[model samples]
Target: MPETTPRGLAGLAFGGDYNPEQWPERVWDEDVRLMREAGVTMVSVGIFSWALLEPAPGTYDFGWLDRNLDLLHANGVRVDLGTPTVVPPAWFYRAHPEALPVAADGVRLEFGSRGAICHSNADYRAAAANITTRLAERYADHPALAMWHVHNEYGVPVSACYCDSCAAHFRRWLAREYGTVEAVNEAWGTAFWGQRYSCLEEINPPRRAATVGNPAQALDYRRFADATMRENFTAERDILHRLSPGVPVTTNFMTALSQCDSVDYWAWGRETDLVTNDHYLITDGRRTHVNLAMAADLTRSVAGGAPWLLLEHSTSGVNWQPRNPAKTPGQMARNSLAHVARGSEGAMFFQWRQSRRGAEKFHSAMVPHGGTDTRVWREVTELGAAVEALAPVGGTRTEADVAVLWDWQSWWAQNLDWRPSEDHDARERADAYYEALYDHHLTVDFAHPEADLSDHPLVVVPALYLMTEAAGRNLREYVENGGTLVVSYFSGIVDEHDAVHEGPHPGALRDVLGLTVEEFSPLLPGERVRLSGPGGAGLDADVWTEFVVPRGAETVWTYADGPAAGRPAVTRHRLGRGTAWYVSTRPGAEGLAALLGQAVEDAGITPRADLPRDVEVVRRTGESGTFLFVINHTAADTEVPLDTPGTELLTGERAAGRLAVPAGAVRVVRLGG
Candidate 1:
């Protein structure tokens, strides 16, 4: 909406969060100097400096931030100025204790960490607005101000607060959404638990009860909490937009992280002028690069297929994970370029200088505790040069070969209590499907279910338990229009109200899939099932199985031996000129690969089957020309099939026909450049 990317940057945006207040005033000079040496063009300042910026109510201290910005501008470094509203100062919290968030158990969260304020509290909103206005008034035209970063990572640590203020706010939100208490009762299915409300005032925030609360109410509360945070963001954003008309405003998003799930990124993506995300690796015995690529692709899609920035990633290990492991040599560059390969304007880290005394002190940074002589510093400088060399690829967008349906609302709805089985995880299904597509060398673009799907010939729905009527119609029409669709288990079961769709199981997708599941036969823990299809094809599945009765679909695979033995486990239907595939059980990796491979073929899409496993190839196209990125995440040297002759950006090597990608190395080719 603003410019599609961060403005006022000469090349690609490259830098990290800079906290000059954390260091002594004397270190400011050295910080900018090192930034220049590392090819840093921008730094986000004052994100958590609320306590320092406003020591007392209405008291102001901008001298330190002014000096820091001036010095960075003098050193040719741009600033992504923060509103410093994520955390209120001690005095403000002391004065307005009602601003503190209350747990679902009715215990008030003390003001000791970040994001402790209740979003519904008027005091916090007023304080946040005041600080934002003051900052906008002071630096609307500052030379170094390139972007306005709003409150840091909304819905992190604290999303919903069960305080009385929130209860009232929830009622008001319900009033606006449903318009009447009868409507709320109907939507919430209050007849079951005798929980019908007489009026909006009787409703609460789904606090602790004897048993599981109303899932419909729980779902609405999640939406309410997300909307409350968004309301605050837009309030601050409107101020910045009014004061600073052209400067793009953004709030770093953790779109792909499991820990931060309350915020619906699709809604937030529309609100931000420029979409940016902060991604950290989980390091949980999986391929971290795949997760990184997934995050980057998701962020780029959130930017509406435009170029987005990587606001925060680690140089090595992060401190918060249960097992923090350092990245091996060259792994950092590979991780960053993998994101670039998908579609990131540039690579940036959490902080420029690592913290010495803070909750995140053990977290890695560009300048680690060991400083410039360390391996991190050396790699940081190398990555800087690499990012600078690929400036021509900045505005270019990565073209996706396939589209994956991703909706946070469905994820939220599916995660509520009293589901089919605990083993059915929405995110896990998404990851499995994404990883399969990645292995097929298919670049993916995530789309909301109701979004236009005509452009993507192949659309995948890994897991979507909650589907709106419009989304169902969209999918049905897409299949009828000759677009191939692949859907996994536990999808299209419920509506927005957490109620099963009327008439049949598999609800909205019943017609499109040409099948209906009468009953879900979830397997016992540690149990597995085998499926046999035509031509003697065999697959192993676990976690779930279903008794699928075909309306018009052909059974491709049947449960060979399980609780639902002889039942259809996988089916295919011919709709219009297109095809729709239904998978009713969770298959192993190899089985999934085989099924997706067939679907890819049905969609008339060609994957890079020539590339070795774990090797990635992505292309970016724009006015600067087409650039092909070949990233090898394996341990052996491999060559990617390339027809066009071009100069490699990373090594300046001339290549034609085929490109050599060494083990753990990244190669960027400016095609015919």
Candidate 2:
């Protein structure tokens, strides 16, 4: 495995995306000076600079890039050099219009925006390879180069293309996956509605249809799109590796966002040398910190518990949201440190300097539009100092006792057109469980359902709708081997092809859960059912309900009032020395927390610390020592009881007993060697 730490960096990597090509040459000197003053150590360059790198077809421009790289090296700032392939130059697309992607409605998308080229387009692939090869060959041994950032966000604007090239590519991919049309028919359940194809050529990308499209076809198309993206990423990565041997390569992942659904990070993680992510806060009354923590945890898990990078986040308000609220006073610092608390060894942003023009003009950067005197720049400098102060955090690994199952295939199939409830979003369900664990100050790591669960004391699978036979067997083995398994409603209902299981509703897990569901009772919008359990522990269940019949599992919670009144809403089954718990309804936060608390107790798992609500704690162990990060996300001052003894890295003061963390602030306590 590639080491999580950046190769030559002395401390935690601190800086943001730097674009010297946007400004005049004189401004480049001033930017480097400012970066050093702010304690910036690294900057990502050449992102979205395809037009500048190659102004015309087969033409290259490296004079300006060479000057900037030399200047940054002289100023002691390392570089994460990007390939500038996210957006192809306009002239190439003008010459080969076939490279433009076609939308689901068959409208050919133009070349004005980024990610406009179809991944399967032969012309686009060739052009991308040519440019990447040139870049790697030119900068193979550059002293300033620290890492290779291959392409910007992959599936952002244009995830799937419906053009002829993509259709052909999709058929070819299906052939590779299924081997024959008959096998495809069996896997896709093409016999339904007489949708079976006689030949491989009949299949196409999931374009718009008169009625609902085939779910199996749509699922396969999603798989194909991800595979194409991975292939594209690997092509660039291979060029970089072959040319610049030891340099780490990565593509920034848009974690926990809607765009993340298109690619499988677990598979992508294997290709990249380092795992990195770009997460912007969703400011619509959602718990932005929770989302950030979730993204960081998932990124760390994808990196195999190694420290990852926070490739992008806004210093203030983002321009994209309907109402992009600016981060108050210390919110930016708090947000950045929250990522560090989880597993990120670096804290970076979208851009180093604010854009003077373009779509992202209003997006916050390290240096705001208002020069160095502004609050954004001041906060950026302070964050840079904080990151520099906590230099020992580099290469540290966050220890997680709980593993939450996150599967992209399950996520895709769960949200398919025909489901139990329209509101049954897979991520939201997973977040609900994750939030419950977060509420308990427990460190959590995301795990694929098929991943080994023996390492984690507690495994929570929320809304795993499409459970494969392998995954089902893995869960059974996990539970039978003394692991605690918690599964929610609508899980293990089908195989990989979106075909329902023959027996029980949660077909594959029925034996492990020791229960069978007679029918699914999906509640209407605003409709809810009451659930009651031991000691009058009650909560409202909404969205979905399963009429579960227990065979050998003991009832933990029952429906108090509904069509399935008195039915087991929650059941626990003991398999050998282990236990499996099933949740048949969408329980409210309090109820879910209570149930998870019971599971945590039963599994003999301990939290890092008992923290107040809205306060987060994470423990990272390394060669240096164990570092505990306590963050207060609330708007008021809070005190946390800390038993570990060590010096606080942020202030270089002794930390023990109780520590006061101000509102929107973080505390990094280095607990003993």
Candidate 3:
């Protein structure tokens, strides 16, 4: 086996999760043979094999793991060794029942699956650290070691705990944050509902209450839970860094999915050597490829535009969806290339081989239940070849002129009980904005509110209800320093502690936006207000509506017919050579497209190429040259016009002027000398 550099795997890693521990010793040989045939460069091992690695407490058994590592090394496959702290052995729970987490309703959650241990438990942390130390010591000098997978997806099953230990930890965390009981009360606005606490022990996790719980307290608890998970990850990561020097360490992130709301990837990215993410298709919506591109873009931004890894994705239909429909003929290849187009150095799936019996038996893998003769295996092999051909794209960066803000704290605050509308879903709102940009064939990157904004010409913030003072200052500075900003409805209404800002609605941003909201008139379900803008653009606004009186901003659009008719539905204010546009209502897809399109043109931003409808185009640049990825996501074939002449790596043909991209296909062209 050939070991890769300490930074990462040598070439584009084209392998998936390989659980050789689940099979017989004889099967390992067959797996390795197939790996070579499929061009697998790396494999993630021991993700959920804690019980097998350490059968008993303070006891170690490495004979099986040693054999598997040797076999993989002999087969020329690099290893992404997992610490196996995601799943605790049953004996662990039996010996230390105190490690179990309690639900919001005070019900002790029994562990029958992985990731059920409380993140704040002392025993669990100690045990996890011990295993990580042992693994790092044993594999530090191994020939096949490529990277260290710190832990499986954090906060997947159980994000927070309400146990006594966790409660105490929460009090200490709050004390460290607020300093005193009076400060905690002031931050939470506890005096409003006579819920003020005089001592640290009086506080606890947000449990069920008679009515809606305190929004500020709930927001703090969400932050505490995310921090606790980060603490757990850092503990193990520190041990690995000390024991195994020069080995890159990372934990897979679930980007933009529901499970990711509890953990902040913006903060987590600072701790990882390289960022990686697992994105599954949303079968119910049938727009899986679009969502995959969005996730990839966000993941790349989290890595600061560095090439990251696509750790997990389904080959075809996933078993978790209500209706698992397998991918169409060329859908698999299109899906994988989409990630690589957006700066992913590697393309990988959830598992290598299909499980015979388990919860994921129906889930598609590289080698499906039908074996290598099936279409799944054929597509997997073809994808491997395509990835190998795209080795030039490795270590490249994707360029985007626009950025959309993503904040977990705002997500928590917006969804908190007692809001303007029950349909205030943070993920859906952000996706709608991203989808509009994607439809226009414009590249985008996800930006944290507090991150540097000078790189992007235009920044779009959708439904950022809770804004920290620093984040608010950053946005203001961005606008004042000549950066265009687009803020949708229900943004900047509160500060970091979920406290409403004084003065007008949209609190801290009232000055920058040059508008004030007097009242909120939420629409009933299935109700909408007609909006008409300049240049014959019109659409219906649903979910929420705010009556805005512009003080300095000029009206760009107004409500046509509704209770809030003749009012400003959209406005734009110019400050310091930059523009700040605000949408006062939830505009439908067409309206958003029209408004965003105008914003792009106004900011002097140009798309990489003028693509046809449903055709996605992105550019990646490196020392070699610029690579243009044109993917036709539609069902019908389309001809994409390329501005620069270059060789198409997939077909070895010199392409220029116009290239025909087949339906559900992709073409990678290396442009420039």
Candidate 4:
């Protein structure tokens, strides 16, 4: 679990969410002792320390915090100071009547529930800003300070937040985005049921339990909410940065969370600096790696294809789940290493110590079993020692030749479509393609839709259902500039307005893909069809079936033995100096692996061949030297042939192709060759 990470703050950041408030003053002594026991140098404090920070709006207390900071400073540990705006005192809520949020169901949220406030609420926003500025002014020169934590889980419980202020702002947001109420109504197809709005206030967000009848409106609402959250995040971030620019600022994002608040990268990434996200892989499973990799990639993408922190991973079982299954022995480290192998720059456990009582009292921790001499502590110590010895692995970076195209606009546009299908959800399909690439030992840079593609030679976008005219044109330019591209089925069916293109299914892409999808034949599970390569026997297509009428492209793969058999399942068309492959069906990972290998070869992308698929290699460049990280994820020990010679980062280790890496072992090698 090693890769080249970001410079400056990039070494093995050994710390996590910390709260000195929960323990007795005497217990803080043991905490310091344990910090040296493990290489724990950083602790994020004040995340939930709001109750202890200020007893009331007018009165504040830092007596406990001063001692906590003094302890960390004396111990030489850095602190990621958090602004306790998440859960303030009951006095603040009682006094600031506008602080509470009105849910979509029109009920003002009671205090106690986290994330139950409208960010647009003037009083709430001002209060949060006030808290951040005060904290910054107080801790600006604090030696224990390493970074600033804006707020704890900014987007949790984001499904609600339909306050009067939010509604008023939502109208303004819609006016700016859609230009006019009539345009908004038309895009939403308000005429379908006479839901047209004559004025902004006439429009109402659906209830907390409301059904998404109009996808266009629903999509816009989702976009507006995301934007609003970003605005709030930026407000807090600016306050912190102004107070202390040297302290890198960040807020933990939740993983691929359904709530739109965690959805948009372009909007919130600017303030986040280095993106960190919370992800809990509920149990030990093969799919866990894929999920963690996706989170790491998302974090990296926000950092502009750089490294990110695995901010919050449970040490064992968490408190809030349908079933709280504890992680098996070695599972926690295994999972954290998976994040490292995939591309997480730094790793930290969720809660340093278990909460003694309350909602998350049972959540796992680094010292769950006891104070210093327990299995969990031993495991943490072993991991820390391994990390310290593996110090050379620090600053190892991951570089990708190919990047998957991801766009919030596409995310918005697809959901805005009238035919936004529950059966063919595009987001899940795209995630599958990305994870497939990861499994193939291909380091893929997860990219925003409009992000620069000039650095990448091959771009894969699966099921991109929503295309604005500008985006389609940009894709054309990318292909014409000699970039190999892959566009899957159900793509380009609708424009930004959710209107069907006149000429064909893929309106602008028909020129690039050289084909048209007449209508999709939704094939269910266990559906059988053979997709063969010219006269090839036993070609496979198990999931989807489609009839392809090629306009100008050559058929590379075809389905067999079905009503749609003998039609093109995979087709390629030459556009400009490059080629475009359109996958008509969702193929298995094996099939996609084969397709990508051939496509990368066709695109002249260097694969670092003669290496095993289970073995991963990434090269990160620095001003002085370049670092190459090799990871072995396979069960059996394997030897990797390296072109590098005498490039040693470890003791008595030689850079040779025959270097043996045990199962789950990672090596940092320099590529002098």
What's the lDDT for all of these models? 0.92, 0.88, 0.87, 0.72
Q: Rank the candidates by lDDT, best first.
A: 1, 2, 3, 4
Name the better of 1 and 3 by TM-score.
Answer: 1
Q: Where does model 3 exceed 4 Å of error?
A: 1-8, 535-537, 607-609
Candidate 2 lands at a TM-score of 0.98
lDDT by residue (72-135, candidate 3, tens digit) is 9998899989999988999999998989999999999886888898989999999999999999
- TM-scores, each model vs. reference: 0.99, 0.98, 0.97, 0.91
Index of the highest-lDDT prediction: 1
Model 2 per-residue lDDT tens digits across residues 23-128: 9998998999999989999999998888998999888999999999999999999999999888988888889999888999999988777888689988888888
Error of 4 at 222 (Å): 0.8
Best by TM-score: 1
Error of 4 at 341 (Å): 5.3
Pick the winner on TM-score between candidates 1 and 4.
Answer: 1
**Candidate 4: worst-modelled 10 consecutive residues by lDDT:** 1-10
Q: Put down candidate 4 lDDT per residue, 432-547, tens digits, no spaces.
A: 78766765667777776556787888889887777666667777788888988888777876676666666877775787788887767767666767678755744565555567
Preferred candidate (TM-score higher): 2 or 4: 2
Instruction: State model 2's lDDT.
Output: 0.88
* Clash number for each model: 0, 0, 0, 9
**Model 4 regions lying over 4 Å from their true place:** 1-10, 96-98, 208-212, 255-262, 282-284, 321-334, 337-344, 389-396, 412-421, 561-563, 606-613, 646-652
Which sections of candidate 2 miss by over 4 Å? 1-5, 607-609
